[model samples]
Target: MSDLRQAARAAGTGGNGARRRPAFIITIDVEEDDAWSGSATVATRNAAFLPRFQALCDRYGLPPTYLVDWTMATSPAFQEFGRAVLERGRGEIGMHLHAWTTPPILPLTGADHRHKPFLTDYPEHVMAAKVTTATRVLEDTFQIAPVSHRAGRWMLDETYARILVEHGYLADCSVTPHISWRGTSGAPGGRGPKDYTGFPEKPYFVDPEALHRAGGSPLLEVPMTIAVRRYGAVVERARALLSRSGPARRASGRLWPATTWMRPNGRNRRDMIELARRALHSGRDHVEFMLHSSELMPGGSPYFRTFRSVEALYDDIEALFAFASGPFEGLTLSGYRARFAADAGRPPESAAGPRRTG
Candidate 1:
């Protein structure tokens, strides 16, 4: 343990605590109907996915985190839904602010959010106000202070770091390693590699400048894990082409060849499980997987529709748990983060046994 502490210090972790083994952290970004770029069924599926997902978590004695958008908070049904998650005890509620839907800050007139880009885009001043309001709403509605966050459309900037800190958000999971998003507005840059940059794959503190230099802010930037390989683009393009042929072909889940569909960056259900398995096997158990709430519903993804109905989503949750309990232990973000912090500098425990990475 002492030797492990020295290694962690050399690795720039600062404190001398043992490092925990790889673990699982599942984060569901609770989004609003308005924030979605395409269809509205995403939110409806999210409403379905949550309870069933939570039920699966409960059965396995694992807790999952839900980052709720402020827009979703307005619906009585959704509000009740959020409370229901908290009641489950295996759930953690966090803010999912959509700046556009959120009102502008007080005492700062003319700060309209209409032209601020995404519905979740909030300029600095307005962002502060929105965070405060959203935090209060989550507390009042669900009676729990959110501990983590993810930006709407994965859109965020340096200013958001300060905003999150002020609002008591311990960690932010918006960055996806080696992946960038391009749209009419512009291309979103990535934070790049962690090993070279001295960033930890597991959650750890970063300077606001390093965070911003990485193109964001200084906080515990817990990036979402993405499976990347040389054939990624080829597979994606072929799937897109097949999906475009007709709704029937896409609906059949036969759009992409099975081999191509399971390749890196493929949208198959097994691809997701592979990513989770890789994180667990790396002895860096801090795995955080994310998808827009809409991704869980039918008509959500053009290339892949894993869940055709609410029951399908439940089945996925069950499959995920079956794997986790059998191969690796699971923990919520807060639980994972706290354990990592406490065990900093210590070597990870022994791997239970060798397992396939993908």
Candidate 2:
């Protein structure tokens, strides 16, 4: 704990003289209707959960950031939601593109699921077109130009960084390290079984050569933290195993179980807690956490096929906010960007982006 205090001091957020504000960035990837399932097409299913999220934020006097997909924005509900977010003055409306959900590849097949060429191999022109269109739509409809982003499915490559730069997106929150996404078509690479020692758990600028590296990209990768025991396994396995009886067993396996991936060997909730603790103790002040907005909705929705109920999502949201708030001061992405700009000797953070186009 003493070392952590020292680290905080060195990072410019230490001592009563320095006045450190712990920063928590919560980024939600909003792509409710773009999933592989046909039934999940209604935008309202995802929109319905927004009010509760808003209520939660209001109660906490915090602004929640919403990254809206262009396709989802076309719906009336989303348009109103976007306006509401802007009106609240607490949220940021940013782009969340699901290239796989548009045009030729949309209405996806099992094959599309197996091979996500829309994201990984699309021509630069095609990719740019998708991003531009979404950017325009959000700007036009909501009257807000989105400056932050998260790629749908976390499926991206170097091409994405170039695309974001072209589209005027300065910060990206993709790239989950210390985990593998094999067989989950279009997912990025992570540590292999033979090597697991390297990878960053916090945010940093995206390095161009990340694609070729064992862990992958540098795009300000704000990966979710994972906690593990001394034996290199997540600590929650015992509870998960114990809950494996009767309806609980069926529920755990089907309804958003804390599994890392489709593979039997996976990360657990404790993994995240451990990482969060380490970051706090190590003097690191920023902890960026994310989850799909679709998962916050009710069960049986196409967006959250794993069928975790709305209540379950609330539990996750409340717990995460409580844990992070208790340890770190929370900041919206915009707030964090401002701090970065200040550090860079540039204009004030709010003065750092392109003008709104609507």
Q: Which candidate leads in TM-score? A: 2
lDDT of 2 by residue, 1-358 (tens): 4554444444454323465745667776676543545443345467666767777766665566677786677767767876887886867877877765554343234454444434545666667777877788887898766777777766657677767755667566655555454434442332111111255555555565563242222123444444333322443564467476777666754544433321111123344555556666666667676666666665434434443445555665565565555555666776675565455444444334443222
Off by over 4 Å in 1: 1-21, 37-49, 105-116, 119-122, 184-202, 212-218, 231-267, 297-317, 345-358
Please write out the lDDT profile of model 1 over residues 137-199, one tens digit for every residue: 777788666667887656655566666766666667766554444422311222211222223
Per-model TM against the reference = 0.67, 0.72
In angstroms, how far off is 306's CA in candidate 1? 10
lDDT for each candidate structure: 0.54, 0.58
